[model samples]
Target: MNKPDPIPARLAALKTTPTHDLKKQWRDLFDSEPPPFNRRYLESRLAYRIQELTYGGLKRETVRRLERLGEELDGGDRKKSRVRADRDRPTTGTRLLREWQGVEQVVTVTADGFEWQGRPYRSLSAIARAITGTRWNGWVFFGLKNHRRGA
Candidate 1:
């Protein structure tokens, strides 16, 4: 006969377990204090930990493969990866249009700069200044900075 699976029962118990017991379980499993999270979060993470402890976690080869992919994606530099992922520049050939003083201004993104009024400009801040006659942040003026993936 096949052995019965205990993972389901253990996971189900997480829902019925007292909050203090869940915190103690978390400390025992993770070897650290429980994070200041809601009960649901605590229960879910405890369930995962219980399952992992019983059945084991990811294989060494899978972890190595993931690390290799991460290195290729970010050149193995965590800071550079963060900076690159946060950059919000639009792709080349994108056209940005804005209305200023009842006149429409158009700007085109190029491989190396931006084009406006048939002239190439080095920076978007310069373009915003040319349009408004005052200093303005190009990304904010163009309404793109506020749309970041994670604020």
Candidate 2:
């Protein structure tokens, strides 16, 4: 019978090893300089790399299936075209502050929408309406999009 791999034991020991020693081990295992990630991230990725080396990586068929699923979910070409549009928008947890009628209003970006006055709104327009009692384009109201005429 083949001898059992020693990677598991080394992975367990990695947790207790000092950062400097871990960096040296990482260099040996990966044959490259260690990244600037934290100790936990380094340990976890190292453990994964050790296991992958001992028991081979995912099969080509599995990788192809994952790519197919990703393309289907993202709608392929449609998703690629929208990438630039999505990049122009603010990310979640961003805070937007605006002053209207001598009162300061604060809105926070969320994963699914925006939050204002401790309430969730599906769009910035809804939050702006609640704040100003008038209809408004949310992206323009929040200064997220330009409203100037084309030169």
Candidate 3:
């Protein structure tokens, strides 16, 4: 038998603790400067820390298993898997609105590809080219990537 951790009870009681006391508690638990987040964030993170410290983290085998499952579900080809990455591709059912030559263009995200003007396109770059009649980076044209001022 092992003694139970007292940190969880203390974390639950954080709701009633004063702001100053909460700061001190944060320092004691994290041994670092407390972030400037609200009280709710502090309490939740502290509670998670307490629970993590009380028990142990996940095992290496579990992480590897999850990764293997993800690779299996994604079909395991680098080029094929790139389409599912969230960085540049919009989620399914999302609508992307753009304006070109004073006309508003709407593109809807589908499971397989994007739909624009009653037509299906393989890539946003193709859509951008069709709209502008010139080659352009799709993410830049759609304002997904940041553009620096005075380049």
Candidate 4:
């Protein structure tokens, strides 16, 4: 029996063909069951051949063709190319107090707490007391109130 020509010979024959055409031929070659020794050796060598051809060129068309060939080699599934977003994406939260019902009606007090118009000064009492010397009366006052020596 005669020895068959190697895959390198076959790949060399394909060099002059268009990239897509070469990929199709290669796919056909891979699909066919070569002899046992030929199968293992050809698979590894063909992969290296592809990578060599891909990175050897600077042309955009060459790069695109290489990418296409890579896609076909990995089972021709476009879904595999998709990437999931990382969990660290920034997020914002709403603060109820930041948006008061009627901000104009709300008062700032020497004693901490908000005083809303038509509503008694009942919220943020501790905040007002901690910030101001006296109790808040729902009026938006900025200046410090005089604290008596004993009150």
Best by TM-score: 1
> Of the candidates shown, which would achieve the greatest lDDT relative to the real structure?
1
lDDT of candidate 4 over 4-118, digit per residue (tens): 7464575565545554554454565456533222222344545565655644534788888888897776555655443111111111221113223344222333222233332
Task: Please give the range of 10 consecutive residues that has the lowest summed lDDT in model 2.
Answer: 142-151
The alpha-carbon lDDT assigned to residue 14 of candidate 4 equals 53
Per-residue accuracy of model 3 over 17-117 as CA lDDT, tens digit each: 88788788789879998766556667777777767677765678998898788789786666766754544566799988899989998888877677788
Off by over 4 Å in 1: 1-3, 78-151
Q: What is residue 125's positional error in candidate 1, in angstroms? A: 31
lDDT of 1 by residue, 1-151 (tens): 9999978988998888999999999999999998765577688889888888999988999999998999999888898986764455577899998888899889998776788888777678888998898999887788766646635
| Deviation in Å, model 3, residue 28 alpha carbon | 72
Question: What lDDT does each candidate get?
Answer: 0.82, 0.79, 0.75, 0.41
Cα misplacement distance, residue 72 of candidate 4 (Å): 26
Query: Which residue runs of candidate 2 sit more than 4 Å off their true CA positions?
Result: 1-4, 73-151
Per-model TM-score versus the true fold: 0.48, 0.45, 0.42, 0.19
Q: Please, what are the lDDT tens digits per residue for candidate 2 over residues 61-138?
A: 999998888778666566674674456557889999999889999998777667788767767887888788899998
Q: Count backbone clashes in candidate 2.
A: 0
Q: What does the lDDT read for residue 132 in candidate 4?
A: 55
